[model samples]
Structure formats: C-alpha cells, structure tokens
Target: MTSPTTRSRTAAACMAVLLAGLAIGAAPAALAGTEDDAGLEQTVEAGEEVVTEDAVVTDGHVDVGPRFLDDEWTMLARDDREVPSVWRDPARTVLHLGDAAVLPAPDGPDYEFLGVEPGTPLHVVPQTQTPDVVWLGWNTQDPRVVDSVEQGATLRLDGLDGPGELFVFLQEGVTGPPNVLWDSGEPLPQELWMEVNTHVHANWVFTEPGIYRLDVTTLADLADGTQAEDESTLVFAVGQDTDPAQALAAVAADTTSDTASDTADEQTADGAASSDASPAADPATEVTDAPEAGAPSSDSGGSAMLVWGAALAAVVLLLVVVGRVLRARRARDAADQATGDAS
Candidate 1:
C-alpha cells in the first residue's frame, strides 16, 4: 500500500514530466511560426519595385541583358556610358540607329548567310565597337544573375515586327563563317544560349531602315533547383531619319493573332478534312508560375539557435525541479525514521 507521502511524490513527478514534455513540444511550434514570419517578410521585400526612368541611346556603349532585380528576373539595358552605370527598363528605352551605323554588306561567300547581296546597303550595328555608333551587346555578368544561375541562360526571340529583315550574328575570326544566332528569314522563336558571367557582342543587321520591335525573353535554371524567366520588348529605330519616339511608342506584335492566322492558313492548305485534328500547343504562349529567386536559406540558423536555447532552458528547469523534489523526499523520509525511533 502506498503511503500519503509516496502518493504526493508520484503526482509531483508525473506533473514535472508532463510540463517538460509540453515545453519541448512548444519550442518546435514556436520556431516554425518564427520561420514562417521571416519568409513572409522576405516575400514582401521581393515584391517592392525599383524606380527607373526613360532613356534613349543613339551612341555610346550599352548592354541589353537579364538581371535579378528585387529577386525577380528582369530585362533591362545597362547604359555603360553613365558615370555610375544606370539600368533602364527596355520598355521605356529606345536604341536609335544613326547615319554612322550604315554600311555596305561585306563582299565574300562568308557573308552570304546575311541574305544580302554584296555591297548592299545595310544598317549594321557592328560586332566591333564604332565610337560614333551605339555599341550594343549583351552580358550575364550581373552579380545576382551570376550567383543564382546554374551555368547559363537561354535568350529567345519570340517575335519580330519590322519593315525589313533582321540578323544577329557573331563573327569570331576574320576568315571563318559567321555564327548566326537569330535570323528573321529563317523562322520565329529562335533560341540563343549564353554562358554565365560572359559578355558578347554581335552584328545586328537590318535590311532596310524602319522602326523594329523585338519580343525577347530570357530563361534560366537557377542554382536553387528552380527556374527564372522574363519577357520584354526591345525597340529600335534603324535609320537616321527614323524617329526614336515612334520606336518607343511601338507595341509588341500580338503573337496569339499571328498563331491563329498561321493555323487557319495551314488548315486552308490542308483542306477541310484536316480541320478535325487538334492544333498543336504554342510554346511561346505557355505561362508558368515561378517563385521569386530568394536569398539563400541561411536565415534558418537564427531560428535553430532559438530552438536550442529554449530546449536548454527547459532541460535546466526540469533538472532543478526534480532535484528539489528528490531532496524534499529524502528530508521527509529522514524525519519519519527519526520519529519512529523515538516512539
């Protein structure tokens, strides 16, 4: 049979164990909440927009490329001529092609890929910099982009709307064939792969002078096992007489309309019998939801420290409580033994 002192001691021991268990369990729940709150704060910060202004470049160096701005993949033009280089949104910027950019197509079979006759006048943004002309190029050297991207990125030409043909090619050596990246005459939606942390210049050829609009997109696989993509329109007034304002005001061509038109034309050519077949999906029109590229998950360290601290504190309190209960039990037992001896 258990005595009154034994019953009380058992109850106290059970209560202390239960309280310790609760403390241990509550620590994880509280840590989880703290982590969630930190994530929300980061999301809010990523959504904030950076202010930008309109810019027009007729001459001087400029790099049109992708960057992670506010933790979002963004397309912007970096004006290198600025004392502290300025980034301009492509939508609000215009590249003006002046008279100095006009040049005759080089005579040689190596240049035949340009689809222009020898000595034909072409508005050429040369691969090599011409001081009087706008030296346009691309780079993936942005600090954030270089850090987040796995290896490289893909630059896609979704559509081109202009009065003449456009060709973007690289001339590696003086005698070798030019490597074509995008040619308007070939097909739509051409892809150009660019290495991370690289800067490259290419020849931008326009068969005729007019306002041109290019729907460009950059896609990349990030280091965090996620993807990033951004689409923007690039406007160019490719002639001295062309107005930069007209290029700036130009809107991207409706890709959906073009796709529908092409489908109708194909069905017409194939006859009514083929109309029963389903149309293929348009890769360019596909939309995806991508989470913002965030800073590394190092913030969890703080929460982990808090959890450890809480666990330590709970363990110390439990030890102190058990020690007091044990000491009290010993004292009561000693007093009872002495009283029995006296009786």
Candidate 2:
C-alpha cells in the first residue's frame, strides 16, 4: 500500500490538473472578439430584407407586425422626447399630427431616434381627447432605447417643393405604462406602445376647424438643422376656416350650458325629494330621459346595490345584538325583584 504522504501528494496533483483544465476551457470566451461570434450584422442596401433583430423589415417594407389602435391624442417620440407634432383633434385625425404632410424631410444621412435611457423610470398615460378618440403609439422596446426618426426635423415632400416638419417614434418594444417625455419640458399623453429601434408617424386631422400652431421643441443632440432653443422648437402655420380662439370660445359656451344643466338637475332632484307638489308627470319630458329599460344603468347600480346590501346586513346584525342585550337585562331585573320579594 502507498504511504499516507505519497497518497496526499498525488491527490493534490490531480486537483491542480483539473483546475488547469477548467481555466483553459473558459479562456476562449473571455478573450473572444466580435468576429468569433456566430451570425453578425446583416446590413441592407434597399433590396429584399429579411427579419433581422426580431424586426419584420422584409422587402424594404417594415411590417409593423400588429397595428396599434389609435386614440385622440397619440404619443410619438423616443425616451423623454415626445414627437413635436401630435393630432390636434380630440379624436385621431391623420392630417394635423403627420410630420410628412407638413414638415419637409432632410436630405442628409438618415438619423435614428432613441427612447428610454437605461435604468430610467418610464411610464405612459393614455387619455381621451374627444368623446370617442383614444391615443396610441410605439414606446420602449426590448433593447430599451434605440434609434428612430426625429420630430421637428424639416422635410421636403415629393409634390410640395417647400420644406415641412418630420416627427418620428419607435417601431416596437412595449405597449403599456410609463410613457417617455421626449425632453424634460413638455409632457405628452401616457399610454403608448413601446418600440425599440423603429419609426412611426402619428396621423390625424384637426377636429375643430381652426388655425392651430404646429408646436415643436427638443433638447436632443440631434443633427444641427433640427435643433431649436438649446433643444429645438418650431411652429407651423395651421390655416382653418374657423379661428382657434373662436372655436375655443364656442367649446366654453357649450361647457357652461352643460354646467347650468347639471345645476338645474341637482335642484330638481332636491325639489322632488323635499317638495309637497308632485313631480312633473314624466321626468323624461322635464329632463334628459334615462337610458332605455334594457340598457345598462348609468349610476353603476349593480356595484352600489352590493355595497348597500352589505351595509344593511351589518346594521341588522347590530340591532339583533342590542335586542338580545335588552332581553338579558329584563331577565336580570325580574330575578332581582323575586329575590327582594323573598326577602
């Protein structure tokens, strides 16, 4: 048999050899260059393009896999930088917010837009512009912030020789929560679909006819021509048959009329509850009629009923407990009276 010291030395040698083998196996990964990697970049020269980088840019046509449902005030921008242009309508109208229709395109190399800096708090808020309009657009993507188009950038359309504005946003990434404001100054709506290195144009028309200012501002270190106000700010001339101020005044008047109607309704409700006179034969004739008999309740009565039922049950239980206490008191008093009579 081998001596204990000899066995120990052999065991130590084996351990050293195993460790050396592991180090040699891991060395290549640590020192490898991009060339050693499999399947590298596939740059396109405007021919039939395949889906590279999870993007569906086949046949020079970027297939935006799923179409985003639009809202009245849709968002268009990269991280912290909102597209300088947006739909002026409370509903989605393609005319106002489209950069290509107004601003001219640049003649230089294509510039990409970036959204969402790494480790930033990104959120989006979706709000309604009109009664029926919903805002929607691309947001942060898997690679977080990447490149796209620039908002407020000047552009030239094919037919219109003069230049106009160009607003751009990401193509695809995420579609919920923490919308990015293009810059730190103006905050756009919240709800937006996230896109990584993609570009999109928000299309819309002005609902109310008016000459609205096409506002553009940015703080990005983009190409010099697109920069404005330390960032960039541009205003386009919007000519409508109606004046913006006049249209706004009309909207205000309608709002006031609604407020007065609401006040009248409150007064009528109070009168009906406390007055001795019978209410008008039909409340429908006196005011806006309630929804149809089969229609869903406007007051959310289903949820209200559940709450009231729970409250009523609690009150009934309290009353029953009180009644039990009273009966117990009566029995105690009778017992005391019988004891006194016995005395």
- By TM-score, the best candidate is 1
Error of 1 at 191 (Å): 0.9
Q: Pick the candidate with the highest lDDT.
A: 1
Candidate 1 error regions (>4 Å): 1-51, 252-343
Candidates in order have lDDT scores of 0.71, 0.29
Regions of model 2 farther than 4 Å from truth: 1-201, 206-241, 276-343
User: 120-211, model 2: which lDDT tens digit per residue?
Assistant: 21111111111112222222221211222232222111111112222222212122111222321223322233233332223122222232
Candidate 1 Cα deviation (angstroms), residue 23? 66
lDDT per residue as tens, model 1, 1-343: 3432544444334322212222111121114235322211110111223337667788887777787775788887777766567678876778888888877665545567767765567787766566678877776777778779998888899999899999987653444456688999887899988777666667788999999988899999999999899998888999999988767655423445667899999878788657657687689996655545773344566788889999999999999999999999999999999999999
Q: Candidate 1 clash total?
A: 0
